[model samples]
Target: MSATIKDVAKMAGVAVSTVSYALNNSPKISEETRRKVVRAAEALNFRPSGAARNLKKRKSETIGLFLNDLGGPFYSQVIEGVQEIVASHDYNLIVCSTYGGENSSAHRFLREKFVDGAIIMGTAISDSLILQVASESFPIVVLDRELRGDYVHNVLITNEQGGYDAVAHLIKLGRRNIEFLSGPSAAFDNTQRYEGYKRALLEHDLPVPKRIAMHGRFLEAGGYQAVKLLLASKRLPDAIFAANDEMAIGAIRALHEAGLRVPEDIAIVGFDNINLAPLIRPALSTIGHSKFEVGAIATQLVFNARKEEDVIILPTQLIARQSCGFSGGVSEQDHDNLVASILHVGGRTKH
Candidate 1:
């Protein structure tokens, strides 16, 4: 075999444990000793065995990224941001999908010590599982979920602020009688958005129609159906605020089919500021968030918790666009700028 930690230690005239401490950059080891150990390791062509190091330290050094589904623009980008930092830190990661219910394999993995820590995607990972993992002293960073206990660190966006901003934007556009197409009633995000919509309406002394604030499944079809349900009553709201971009797109398509022009007829707003929001006709106006930053922060949290640290909360912003009567990013030049934006920096903000 190539040179091992033992060989590096022997060559450096130090204990194997000392070599490990130095390699890990542990504070206990002196910098001179660390340099000498590294120098010897290089001379001997020594490579740290992940298996051996984990066994010695009792840490897998691999973070588990568990989500309800691996597909979707949100998760895809979130994973990208997580991977970017994780690769730099010399930490391996295991991607697990808990889709279609509580995955017995994942549950087993968590209980059996399969990872150093976990980065959970929003509310996809259940509260029951959260409790179960915490019982075993598992370090977890939960995203998008309002649930938290002593051990679980929550990394969340202000869903309520996003919701309020979207609706409030429509209100500023002289559109009143706005209806909220919400996500699943039990979803924390849905509740927060619903509360925001209600708060905006109440602040403006707008009538809160009991039936107007209908529930959508955070999908395109859900938005279509929700709008159709309201349309069947012939009491159409002046504007619609969907909890997500997909639902809003669906609602817009349905409205188009009915010969209702967006903004000119009925203004619409969407949450998430997804990629598709600015691609289609009339280019959807949406409330934006840094999913990449959220993922980055969550990944950082997992790393910190692996070494034992505190939790964090990130912020959100509103993105004005065409469909919601905002002047930003409706034209070709803005689109080019947006694409150019992707090439520049991290947490890449766009128009």
Candidate 2:
């Protein structure tokens, strides 16, 4: 059998309480007694149980990160940033997907206090659940939705501005018949982006024909299916603005299969300058932001000592590429240089 605290106390000829105080480094225990207890524990190969220690102190020294799903290139940089910050602070990170909703392992982790705090990145988990658990003194940082609560904070990107910029870019290129490929209707980012698209259209005196707007579910398959449906109608928009790069890429594939060329027959723009956006055929013009920074900031907020709620909004920038039919009046050499610069920064290369 393994040695316990009692074994250490008996070996050190001290009381069990003294062993506990010494092991925990209590100031009440003298230096001599602490050293003696340490020596006894080493001699007996006694290792304290992490569960017992955490139970006593009510701190797990760990944080949980919840996402909708774990499949995608988009999450790579974000996860890296979160892991870096968590490790720097000497804490462990537990990543879980809340796709299972109430029965998700992440939900159980939160309920059982397996982590000190949590960073949520998806809408699959309800705000009501977050508010209820956070009300009990647990800190939560939500990345997908904004919630007002004493213990709930938000880290979000300027999605509305991104959407406006995309549609406005298409408008500047003389594309009046533009179509919107949207994500899930319930997504906060999707709603914000849709608002921006509408604002830009209204400002430019452009018509937002209801027939041209379609839901893409933020997935490549959704984009492909939506485009196929549009093709069946025998009417194609001059430009398409997908809410995300994945959907944009899907739309590109669907267009190619339909004997149409990007930026020649139909221009396209997307949000979230994902790693593959610039490498795809014709290249994708996109709204760019540092997903790594978003993750880092969210993790930092969860670990912050402040007891008040905080909200952070990260900025976004527009990246023009061939997909938008805007080459910035640059020569072929200059375009090559621009691509090289983007590749250098993103650590990717054309295949």
Candidate 3:
């Protein structure tokens, strides 16, 4: 009962191949011919198969959001931003996570032509893996990594500066002997943030104690484990700078369980001021990145590439809250913190 390309071609008085070419907007086809073919298809209530169109144009009008994990509150905001942009052009979105590793089902979809472009998240993805993906000649927007190449577009925050600022704030509070809760060693973000922490301590003429640098997986569990380890140690640092909010929250939980009060006992700071940062008791002082803006920016990049435009970068910020010694008005503080965080993280940190 459905009208096919063949029927549309018959109605247009052209070959099926001609219809395909015209529908794909091939340069070889004249504008008049395209107009006529489109009119015919509309009159006949015909629709071309996505696969058939993909075969001709080598595009699927679909973009992928690839990440290492999607098990957090932040990803939802990013998804909303991406959808807000992609929906404007009727483009489809396919979100997949490489839960296992690089060669995951999500990555496989890219290989099989399921999508035309990609927005890749996760710092754990190696440069080699990205280079391999870019070799496919498809446009890709990378989040969380600072990558540069002909086919790769990068949108990241000023991670090191954020790390530096958090530690500096602690020092300003007259808190010395700060501990660092780092993410996975292989993660690019972790490396940058850790470097920033070290830089802050060095600039302030403070000691970078190996015993104070803790390794975490950027998850709540990792934060919990790291804090527990520190608690069992001989001494506790005056402050803890977690690589992300989850880790900060985890550390907070551990501190609470051990009958230690946050800030008053041990101040805390975090990155990725994710949604739950304020909800978690004393709230979390963190570097804020608009997960929504990141998603929107990445989606826009894919669209730009499809339209033959250059790449663009969205910004980041820092939010201060109870977790870092600030108190009262948690919700209002979160809103303002998100804004402040974005500005600072984007290299425009106001006083």
Which stretch of 10 consecutive residues in model 2 shows the poorest summed lDDT?
A: 342-351
Looking at model 1, how many pairs of residues clash?
Answer: 1
What's model 2's lDDT at 206? 88
Per-candidate TM equals 0.78, 0.89, 0.84
Model 3 lDDT tens row, 1-351: 999888988998999888988987889899998998999999988888877766666678787888788887768888898888888988888888877664787768756647877888885456676556563446788877777765677766678888887888788777898999988887878888888889999999999986545777888998998899889985788899998888898999999999999989999999887778878888788877667777777777776664233344444445668877863223445656655665356432211
Q: Write the per-residue lDDT of candidate 1 for residues 1-351, one digit (tens) a residue.
A: 687778888899999889989999999999999999999998988888878878877878788888766665657768877887788799887888875455544555676768877887645556777667763336787777766564667777778887887777788888897888887887777788888888898898887777545667887888988888778878787899998888999889988888888988888888877779889788888776666666777777666654233445444567677787775323434534553454245333221
In model 2, where do residues sit more than 4 Å from their true spots?
1-3, 42-46, 135-137, 329-351
Model 2: number of backbone collisions? 0
Question: In candidate 2, what are the lDDT values of residues 160-251, reduced to their tens digit?
Answer: 99899889888888899888998989899988998888888999998767653577888989999999899888888999999999999999
How does each model score on lDDT? 0.75, 0.84, 0.78
Give the least accurate 10-residue stretch of model 3, judged by summed lDDT.
Answer: 342-351
User: Which residue pairs does candidate 3 place in steric collision?
Assistant: 316-342, 317-341, 317-342, 318-341
Clashes of each: 1, 0, 4
| Best candidate (score: TM-score) | 2
Better candidate by TM-score, 1 or 2: 2
Regions of candidate 3 where Cα sits further than 4 Å from its true position = 9-14, 18-43, 135-137, 211-213, 306-316, 327-351
Rank list by TM-score: 2, 3, 1
TM-score of 1: 0.78
